[model samples]
Target: MGFKKDFILLTKPYYCVNILLSLSYLLAKKAPGICVYLFTPKESECELDGRETEILFFLAIVVMIRTRKTGSVTMINYLTSSFIYTKIANLILWAYADYLYGVIFGVVFIITALVIPEPTYSGPEHVTYFRTEHALDDELESDKRIVWIIAFYTVWNPACVNFAPIFSELSAEYNLKNFRFGKVDVGRFPATGKKYHVSDSSLSRQLPTIILFKNGKEFLRRPCVDVKGKLQTFFFSKDNIKAAFILNTLYKESKENGITTDEKKQK
Candidate 1:
């Protein structure tokens, strides 16, 4: 019930402003009790104002762009808070002061956010790392055989570093304590790279390849090979990975199989 209330309150800007100001007051060694009176010259002036409407409109645009994203309440909350906070600052410094200032400030903030680093995530994870090819093989063919969505990556690849967070967040949600995520450092084990047909060289197109293993065998791999043995191009975006891997189906199968542990050793 407490979580639900807080969740609903997340969408309310008036309360958010009050809390923010109160925290700021406390930080500055001032009494926060007085901060509640902010933007409230009259006690009953608590209605959805033009400032909030403006902020919410832009917020709607941000949300719409991420419609395909599922799971990760942390991602949702961080985005909501950051965008609202930026808009609130924009409203105070420009919008409320002058009509034209508001328009310019709003656009600037949105553009700036697009380039800045997003919030850091330190949440759930169920990824397994294999040191050698032998270790990786044993786990995949183990008695408690289940789905394994493995990421074959090299440390030197910039694309793999960028994809790390996306992979971790996905594991936090869909992996569900099942060790569904596996990582193989093809940089360290080049033989493993050849075994999986992933190349680790600097100019290689398959630096960070995602493969799905099921029923103790390889099931699907992105940048899927054609019948003629040519590798097709694949975009490694989060949406593309989800769709190509059919994460939703894999997640469902994990539940149906009653996978209570990540590995046989854990059992």
Candidate 2:
């Protein structure tokens, strides 16, 4: 399960960076060598110490909390955050053995936070936007020959935001008459989420759930519950999704049939 995408990428990089920088004002200690080298060697304030570390660490926690309190993952976001969390955690573990690991992680985190860019996508995807539960249900039941892939998402969930571009890319790449793509923003339409058993909560493990529909019925869904009812983690990646949904096979089959611009003539 995502669990806010394994508890990372819940906060926007800018938001977290801004918080840390603003909090730096309270630090009256000396900056670490990394910080001094990056910015000012002659530091009057904004230092690093045990208590200061506590505050900054707490501040990092604040980034996570605030992002979650507000909203987590994507293929890019998921991959990036996964790497970050793994490195940071491993750094902590190795830091217990030697201090170098901690130093490296601190330097990198500080540097990355300073220069990390925020998402700036503002275009629309080439997928049908389902605005209501009734419309979704009707569309699903309306066509049996058509295969549908739907992304269940929310506005505040970073995981969804990250996957948003990938989803759009897939739709554009795999556009076909028999094969279609769609999205439902559970944030805007809570009833649709409730009807589909997907939660719109920021902490929901299935915020960016993807399901395949065929013959007016659900054929497959990612992050599905296991035999014990525990949700399984589904990594969002183009290759992963293509294989999981058998996009190549479907694409070939749909391509065999012409792209149906005139549904009337075909039906």
Choose the strongest candidate by TM-score. Answer: 2
List, residue by residue over 1-267, the lDDT tens digit for candidate 2.
Answer: 246733454376754663343433232124455445544566553344475456447646655653442223333353433334434543453354348745765676678655875555545567999986678888887777888999999976767766777788899889877789999998898898898889988678887899998787889998799999998877677778899999988888878974466773656
- Candidate 1, residues 58-150, lDDT tens digits: the string is 655655443223121343333443444445544554456457756765665565456543434456777889997777789876744677888
Clashes of each: 0, 6
What's the lDDT of the predicted structure labeled candidate 1? 0.64
Query: Which regions in candidate 1 have their CA more than 4 angstroms from the true location?
Result: 1-121, 177-179, 261-267
> After best superposition, candidate 2 residue 114: deviation in angstroms?
19
Error of 2 at 76 (Å): 6.0
* Distance from true location, Cα of 108 in model 1, Å: 29
Tell me the TM-score of model 1: 0.52
